[model samples]
Target: MSTVACPDCEARVSLDTPVLNEIVECAECRSELEVLSTDPVVLGRAPEVEEDWGE
Candidate 1:
């Protein structure tokens, strides 16, 4: 497990074998976060999720 700081709340979050481009929810601020890097465990705010309309 690796500890990372949440971008939204700066809260330390623990992740296990985090993969790049994976989305994770912050437990502190409840913000969606994306795993940018796994080497050092870097997190960034995830992009807004939009509903897809049936084409």
Candidate 2:
């Protein structure tokens, strides 16, 4: 997941890769956020996981 800040509305937005090339409006302040760069975005979350995905 990735988090981006809206300069227009100063909203903290969170999204995944699919939302990468998308222009979404900030729900908080209704500002347009254009994902300018295709570079993968990363949030400052923990870099580790505990559970396995093979269920």
Candidate 3:
């Protein structure tokens, strides 16, 4: 398993076979996190989902 720091809480987050753009939640802060990179397991805050209105 690989470990990365949470962007929001700075807590250690473990991931098994992490993939790029994988979404995970922070156990300490309960914040959504996204996998920015997999080489060293970099993590960042997940982008908020926005609803698209019909144009």
Candidate 4:
């Protein structure tokens, strides 16, 4: 998980969550924070396809 400190309230925000495109309130300053994108978002390499021919 990743955390980004809020510029307004300096709160540690986790960027590794699945919930994106949402608004969150700051615990300290009570400021509204818009969740932009989740962290650790990536695409895995394609797996090799095996042949169906019987050996």
Each model's lDDT: 0.89, 0.58, 0.89, 0.55
lDDT tens readout by residue for model 3, 21-50: 999998899999999988878998899998
Candidate 4: deviation at residue 48, Å?
48
TM-score attained by model 2: 0.54
Q: Whose lDDT is greatest here?
A: 3
In the range 1-55, model 2's lDDT, one tens digit per residue, is 6777766655687776634446666678766566666465422222233688787
When summed lDDT is taken over every stretch of 10 residues in candidate 2, the lowest stretch is: 40-49
lDDT of 1 by residue, 1-55 (tens): 8988898888988888899999998888899899998887889988897888965
Q: Which clashing pairs does model 1 show?
A: none
Query: TM-score: which is higher, 1 or 3?
Result: 3
Name the regions of candidate 2 deviating beyond 4 angstroms: 18-20, 40-55
| Prediction-by-prediction clash tally | 0, 0, 0, 1
Instruction: Give one digit per residue, the lDDT tens place, for model 4 in 1-55.
Output: 6566665757665555535645655566666666555664322222335898998
TM-score of each: 0.84, 0.54, 0.92, 0.49
Q: After superposing candidate 4, which stretches have Cα over 4 Å from the reference?
A: 14-18, 40-55
If both were scored by TM-score, which would come out higher, candidate 1 or candidate 4? Answer: 1
